[model samples]
Target: MKVFTYSEARQKLSTVLDLARSEEVIIKRRGGEVFKVMFKKATPSSPFDVPGVKTNATTKDILDAVHDSRARKLGI
Candidate 1:
């Protein structure tokens, strides 16, 4: 764990944050108040990142299915 006073933390804010990514960081106030900092994992942006079902399908099979669905026919 790393500890820094308010003045020190303010002076090296970037360094403090980089250290916080790996371990705990503490910031102390003159009045004896303390604060903790830690890294938070980022969330995925893609909706397809969700869990998938087991499948025996190949890439060609999947693309062929998509192509068939999009094909035009005279009789609808």
Candidate 2:
């Protein structure tokens, strides 16, 4: 990830876009605080593979698993 100031991104919009299409770039303010701009690799199934998400478990499934685990641990 690369951080670029607002002015730099504004002046080099084309280059920024090109870089963003290939890699992640962070656009920030003068104070070094980032407000916007996130980049990701180009892919077709990008939406399917998400981090920290369990596609196989629903709310009820999670509750059931928790209940089972708790019962086993507590002997209840």
Candidate 3:
């Protein structure tokens, strides 16, 4: 863990963040306030990736339903 005064942290903000990646970082204020820095790693995923809904419909059934809907919409 590393502790730095507010002024020191401001001067070495980059270093403070780098150290926070692997450990804890604390910043102290003259008025007796303290703050902790944490690095939150985000997980990578595709925007199209999502949980699927369980249904009894098959691929062919879904296609047929779409075609029927379009045909009605176009007055075909």
Q: How many clashes does each candidate structure show, in the order listed?
A: 0, 0, 0
Model 2 Cα shift for residue 23 (angstroms) = 0.7
Best by TM-score: 1
lDDT of each residue in 1-76, candidate 3, tens digit only: 9999999999999999999999999999999999999998765598876678999999999999999999999999
**lDDT of each candidate versus the true structure:** 0.91, 0.80, 0.96
Give the per-residue lDDT digits (tens) of candidate 2, residues 1-76.
6678899999998888888776788898877688555565556577777657548888999899999999999999
Candidate 2 lands at a TM-score of: 0.43
For model 1, how does the per-residue alpha-carbon lDDT over 1-76 read when each residue is reduced to its tens digit?
9999999999999999999999999999999999998888777789877767889999999998877777744333
lDDT of 3: 0.96
Clashing pairs in 2: none
Model 1 lowest lDDT segment of ten: 67-76
- Pairs that collide, model 1: none
Of 1 and 2, the candidate ahead on TM-score is 1
* Cα RMSD to the true fold for all candidates: 5.3, 11.1, 8.4
